[model samples]
Target: MSKGRILIRNGHVIDTEPQPVAHAHTDVLIEGGKITAVGRNLRSKGAMVIDATDRIVLPGFVDTHRHVWHSALRSAAIDIDLGAYFRLLGQVGPKFRPQDVRIATLAGALECLDAGITTQLDFAHIAYSPELANAAVDALKEAGLRAVFAYGTPVNVTAGGKLADVRRIRERLADDNALVTMAYAPLGPLSTPMETVARDWRIADELDLPLTIHLASSPNNEQPIFALREAGLLREKTLYVHANGIGDDELKLIADSGATASATPGDEAGRLRRAGITTGTGIDTVAFAPGDMFSTMRAAHLAGQIAEDPQLTAKDVLRMATLDGAAAMGLADRTGSLRPGKQADVILLRLDDLNMLTAERDPIGAVVTEAQPHNVDTVLVAGKVVKAGGRLVHADLRRTARALRATAAAISGR
Candidate 1:
């Protein structure tokens, strides 16, 4: 049998444990993709040693909600309101062919990996054809990253065209279980018909796969929830993307159904800023952010405290972004904590960074309030070093960025 071991030495391990931070200087042992031990002075004879001195080791980030196809269009929709955003999705999203989707998805996934995100739930809604879906999935696999390709159906342009041959794709991916999982992403109520939504839910239920849908964005739009109820498809297996506009009845339904919510508080705050609205409307869903997990956690914490109770702590925010996100993606049992026997999806943050240093009194608060992507010094996924010393190790990012730019230009007719 093939054997390998990696020893990460002298790092401050922060595994989302409830106790008051122990083992300031310690080592972690990884053997065959799982963490075997975490403590001081680990036996490392014949194992590859990684110096982790002066670093803070924690579980790798799990991005619960992200549109990887929009990587090339980062901040491109900043000026557009919600309606214009939808217009762009309707008009320009379908213009992307399979190649475009491949380049964008690969680039986006690589970006997340380089920035310490180990698991990403990519809401790929640009499935104009089966070829497009296949290409998107291929891109994720090629990146050698852990990901969930939330395969979304095409919009109304193609009447009765299925997104992709789900059976064929499943068969192709069934054996290769290293880092990819597929899920159904039925475009929320606004873009997809209710009957079609029910059909998608049925397919997911039959396959025992998770279902993801966007809901509760605008306070004026209750149609998504209403449509789900009408179709009798709202259940525990469903993952509601956003609950920004969900009412008390909707929250109760979500809580009772045992379904999960993945909220992007930073994006919601950005949207609210752009539209000149209050940020409190979308506070109920599971909060998350792609580029900046700290901002998301802080925003969610403040929102929760302001709207509900003022005594909420920083741990609550951390749990929402870390553990809650993992649960929402059905990956809590495997990740979301620094437990032995689990995949070593982990990261090390440099606490000496300026933003992280000031709030030293509360390390969790410091991470939630001050730390940013730059503070992440190392990232590991499944016992492999993907990023170290703040740089990517697996793929050439400059090439990917150039390719993505060219593809975006072609699709946008620029």
Candidate 2:
């Protein structure tokens, strides 16, 4: 194995484990895509060293949910309700050519790296063709980010052809696991036929790959749960996204299936649009948000509180965003926490930041409530410096932003 040279020193390591608050200073040694050592007075020659004296080192955030294609549409449908937004996305989604997906995904992936998100579950639903899927995967790889490219089979494509095409694409792209993993992302029940969704799940199971689907995004999707139950397709391998409208029975089914759930509170709150609905109706669902883990933690904490369970701790919320999320995506063995032998995917949060300084005693509390994207000083994906001083090292932010603006304008026909 080849070793990469990099050293991070003089930082307060804030891993998931709870240690003494005052034990702050430490050195981290990174060699060949993994953390070789972490302690005081670590020595290494001919290695690049980063001064992290005032920063808080942590495991890089894992964003379990995001529509990367919607990066250009940030707040585009802010005034429109959910129904209208869906209609608009449905119309606009297919209009995007493969080039558009490449640009949008590249921009979104770069933004995530800049925001200190090391690993992301990019639910790419804009894959109207195999070329679009390949383009999105290529963009993620070029950005040097870890991602699971969930290849979405558009309803139109499935209706136009047979299931064999989906299988062929999965087979061709399943082995390329350098920085990107391929997963099956079937459009959820409301838009896609239940039979196709089940067929997709069967293929996913046969290939032993993680399967993701948008579920219970609205009240109308309740019937899909029953359909899944009838088909006996609800299983742990199935990762359900935005399952806000699920009930107790569905929760039991999920628990029995050993499946996992991801909830994006920020997007769910209609920050982008009214979206008609107020909150997802899922049961025992975990909270999630792309690009920002602090907000996701807070949202999970609040959701637990709303369920009359005020005893939920910040650590619990953090786990959902980190470890639980990795398990949900079936990548727990490789990443998730800061442990020996795990990939060195880590982030450094500035403790002195005003938002993070309030709770000095509880590091978890500081991370969940006080830390923001700006507090991120450094981010490492697979033991590489992707973000330093809160800026992307390999991304051209200004140009990407301009391109996204033009793409959005074109889509809106303005």
Candidate 3:
């Protein structure tokens, strides 16, 4: 609209950049997909103006780690623990055909957008074949979300792509500036041999792609971070997911290495933050946890209070969901905050909604503690209006629903 110029006017703007700040009755101007100005009474010729009155305009949420393809199996293992969840996925992962992966990934990405997650690092460990990997990436592009499609080994599958296939996928996703980029999601030191881990890290290093892997969420006592350090494979481009049950010493090592960590709400997120690690919020899986960042932030806050950690405040949790998460995924400079020259990945939440009606005094606290997905009134990615007036634009939800149901039924034999 208006030749790629949008001006959001008269909103309570919140920014989580160098630090968290709130500006009342502010305006934002976006031109050609980049934020040009954020202040009072901003003007742009031929700009399409959207009134953000009684709305919380802020940077969209970033999910540092998510198994997006598993959204097809949502709540399938909600009652199970990590070990049993893996066991169940062992059976379910192999049953996903290429088309099934496509539908699941598309639905998943749309779900993320609906919940105000403008960016996600998809830990797609379901690449059972080259075709499957392509299907997942294609679905991300189709859904139009900013994503990092981390190519990884499929679970419990023998005849599928291996570490070498990472190189193959890298060839296809070479453009780093695209909406959908690539990462390497290798089985880290805990699951693979030392030599295999070394090789995978080298491949990712050579490709200049970020590395993300699950670490320290299991009962095993192995020090995966330490192992990476001793092997000289630890790098800042690596994102360690679910660093639960890790000791303080290991957390210090993560901080010292300049590496980042992702913590799902139910995990040891508070501990990670208390240890001074740059922790970000992750939904982990829709199959087991809520997909919305509001719920994720609430859970993280409650967990911090339960642990008696004094460092966790509402602002802190909000930062974890926004700028910190972007930094964790190495995209902070491009899309995290409401700053000039950054991509316009932003959302507006209606403060008039019953769930958020009392957010006038402490908007950040209400956002973390009271807001829900239904309050999201508008969403934009790269200056494009993906959602407006509480509905997705150019989306065929009925069709997506039918395909999702058929795929889930086929996979479940129901």
Candidate 4:
């Protein structure tokens, strides 16, 4: 794999370092690990040149919510809904050991990279031990993906034990600029005690790490927004996931605090708009929401349309999939978009492909509305070609898939 300097020439670039900057045809230079330049006809020696003639170059996707360690149970919970998910996870979650977590996290992270997602928040709600947490971090490091290993505290772990393990893991993976980093996946006030939640939130804040929690899903884990508000814990660094069915008051609370929301968006536009939230999109479960950020984007767009909100656009929806997502993961200053001095995490989408040939009139529209993972022809993480020519360059997917399959079989007694 070419892991050094790369110069991609002659691609239509969608550079959203913040606002969108579209270049009809330009050059982007990458040296070491950062984007050196983005312009027309740039020249640099010793850089491996990539001819992106028929490609659309954009910043790689940021997926804010994915239970990546559940890859071992891919088809295990697809048909189930919100209620069954909690019950099933309660039953099957304990079955996974450290080896299974490593395999699942590595394989799942590679799949996201292959799908043009350069950064992810792996909601690893399976960390039952310090060894398991370490294995999870090791898997992300080995996969060479930028990630937030959200430490999902096991039910059996005391609050003190949770903090201790998180401290150990964070110190071990102490590089704030490392490709793999740590985040707190607190159970929140709904599942965890209020005092414990406060303590955990304080720990995350003091560590300068991001915090992500399952948001106020109704009929079970409801009213979490108020609980968090009462404690004065809602802030910009916190990412509330699957923020469905939240009330207008809760929306005001979230929006006013400078916090952000992540939506899976099966049907969530009304609440999101009411909250006046700059909502980011995410793929939640391997059993359901795989590495399909495009689908989530489309769902968000449709939700806005369905709610009759006139402020939505396909391009802004695309922003949710990229820039806003980086904000949700608390990494906007690093890996979200194509800019000088930011990490070179980018993707080359094949606009010459069948589905895009006729629909390529509007690049952002085509990408948001029609393009799927199949159109992702190349992916780069930190200037390295992790996936090229529509395939992952650094992983043995078959071996990993086989191991997951075997693990699933044994767990099911099949």
Best by lDDT: 3
lDDT string, candidate 3, 186-247, tens digits: 87775776777888888788888898888883433278778888999878888888876677
lDDT of 1 by residue, 64-168 (tens): 878787776766666557677767678777688888889988987887776667888877777777788888999998886678887776554542356346655
Models 1 onward score TM values of: 0.86, 0.85, 0.96, 0.94
Off by over 4 Å in 4: 155-161, 217-222, 269-276
Q: After superposition, how far is residue 65 of candidate 1 from its true place, in Å?
A: 1.0
* Better-scoring candidate (TM-score), 3 or 4: 3
Worst 10 residues of 2 by lDDT: 278-287
The candidates, ranked best first by lDDT, are: 3, 4, 1, 2
**Cα distance off (Å), candidate 2, residue 39:** 3.3
lDDT of 2 by residue, 1-414 (tens): 123767788877766533212236787788888877778878868788888777777777777767787776666565677667767777778888777788888887877777667888887767777787777877888777788877776544543243464566667666745578877777757566667667667777777677777777354455666778888777766677765565656555666666666656522322111221112211111111234566566766666656532344566566656665666777776667766677888888877777766444666777766777789888888887878777777777788888877887887783
Question: Candidate 4 residues 285-366, lDDT tens each?
Answer: 7676555788877877777776655555787778878887887677888887887988999999998899889654678887
Model 1 TM-score on a 0 to 1 scale:
0.86
For candidate 4, list the clashing residue pairs, or say none: none
Ten contiguous residues minimizing lDDT sum, candidate 4: 153-162
Q: Against the unseen true structure, what C-alpha lDDT does each candidate score?
A: 0.69, 0.67, 0.87, 0.80
Candidate 3: residue 121 Cα off by (Å): 0.7
